[model samples]
Target: MYMNKSHSRIISMVALVATIFVMLFSVAYSSGHVNHHCNDSADCPICSMLAQCESSLKSLGTGLIAAVFYAVVLSQIFTVSLDYKYQSVQTTLVSQKVRLDS
Candidate 1:
């Protein structure tokens, strides 16, 4: 099936938005707010920052996977719509044989 320019643009936008959101989320997580390590084991900005960085990496990975899944889902929906629209191409009505009286 042929993809229109708008459909391709929408797909690109989805990817771009996902990437941007994930990047922002990672940055926010790495800023020490998401992983403030202050217990008996460790209590310092460096420790907090380290934990935050680790969490950020994990979050980024998860976000990437989620984005891929969503993109695939959207593509499938688009494909299904395309298939429905051109379903007549699958069978030729003019080729159907009919008796004079049935």
Candidate 2:
């Protein structure tokens, strides 16, 4: 399982997209079937599904929000650090062993 950085990134992006789609589908399904016609029984499939969707929305919504916030912050931090490093690391003629003799 020796995957490269680009491959890993693509896989992670796909997984994230899949998760978002699932959450969106859950939201749509739950809302569209809010007034489901079913007896208030202990083993109602619709009720059980709605409950599961509710839980997924709660957990995934929170997790996605936090992940987005952290990702933005970290990207900004890395950009600034890289810019600083590039700007600070300068080479002179002397450092490069270049000389002018008389």
Candidate 3:
């Protein structure tokens, strides 16, 4: 689907902000130290697995957020450039028409 210049800019800004907020929250949540008390051998694997899972999830979340942020910014840039190009062409066309009508 295609969106107009203003609409696309707003959407991109909102997405970028949302992604940054999520990234910050995830980083903070993952940085906090968790103390796990394991009494038996069987419990040790569970605790280790849980930690590993959390770490993996944090890494994945960070990567995904970064990707989204970059994508949004790039798209915004592309849209703005397109709009500028379009306006320039329109102005040139109008000037040529005025000259011909004179």
Candidate 4:
């Protein structure tokens, strides 16, 4: 089986996208989300801070993951086009063989 450069690029892009998603999910659940300070219920600044920080972390993580997906998708799109070209060549070769045999 012949492997094309485009196939390699597509696999690489998929790996990159998967890596980005894992990084984002990890940061969302693994960051410092603990409450170490106490204040009045109406003015629980520590809790508010943690919430805001977690929100920001989630947003940033998601954005980074999306960016990586976009880049990888672009790379894979080109690879898919190359694969299409390969498919056409393959079909033509098979048809030629059929004609030569007859």
Candidate 5:
């Protein structure tokens, strides 16, 4: 069961990376091969590719924003949880069961 989950996670991570690469490549390719003399025709290949690149970039931007938001939220949650846990079992004389000599 654990192995199956791990495999899925790895596959998902690879897929996400591949998607990022494809989006970047599309944008780069479109920019490098921009159609300077576009006649606003319906059959313009470069224009179509550029449109797709723009769409991909927008989706990537949205994903980035959500990822950042989630990362910040998760960091704060883990920080609070860890701080509370440490405080509960913090090292002190009472916590260590020290006996007074007096």
Candidate 6:
């Protein structure tokens, strides 16, 4: 579990890069428009319903993407913190062992 300071730094940098990539991707995808075609018939209940449904789905999709992006970022952070803590504990244990042996 113990990782050198350099290794930890590398892992952090990678995580940062991944976070940025995901954010950019999500933004690009969300900003793209969705094309829906409906007839121009007066009193067409189907067209009205379809438009409402399309709007609702688009909103839902955006919300889902945002949620997923946040989740990925948070999980990466949590993993890095856990790894750092584990490394610290291992280093402490090794130092203690060395002193005891001496």
Evaluated with TM-score, which candidate comes out highest? 5
Most accurate candidate by lDDT: 2
- Residue 49, candidate 1: Cα error in Å is 0.9
The lDDT per prediction is 0.73, 0.89, 0.71, 0.70, 0.83, 0.67
Which residue pairs collide in model 1, if any?
Answer: none
Model 5 — TM-score against the truth? 0.69
Candidate 1, poorest ten consecutive residues by summed lDDT: 85-94
For all predictions, the C-alpha RMSD in Å is 9.4, 6.2, 9.8, 11.8, 5.4, 13.4
Each candidate structure's count of clashing pairs: 0, 0, 0, 0, 0, 0
lDDT of 4 by residue, 63-86 (tens): 889999999999999989877743
Q: Counting only residues 3 or more apart in sequence or on different chains, how many pairs clash (N, Cα, C under 3 Å) in candidate 6?
A: 0
For 1-102, candidate 1 gives per-residue lDDT tens digits of 999999999999998897677667667656646445466546576665666667767777898799999999999999898887534545454456544575
Q: Per-prediction TM-score, please? A: 0.43, 0.62, 0.45, 0.42, 0.69, 0.45
What's the C-alpha lDDT at position 14 in model 5?
Answer: 100
Between candidates 3 and 4, which one is better according to TM-score? 3
Alpha-carbon deviation at 4 in model 4, angstroms? 38
Estimate the overall C-alpha local distance difference test score of candidate 6.
0.67
Tens-place lDDT digits, model 3, residues 1-102:
887999989999998897677656555544553555568846576566556657756776788899999999999999898887434545566676655655
Q: Which residue pairs clash within candidate 2?
A: none
How does candidate 5 score on lDDT?
0.83
Error of 1 at 68 (Å): 1.1
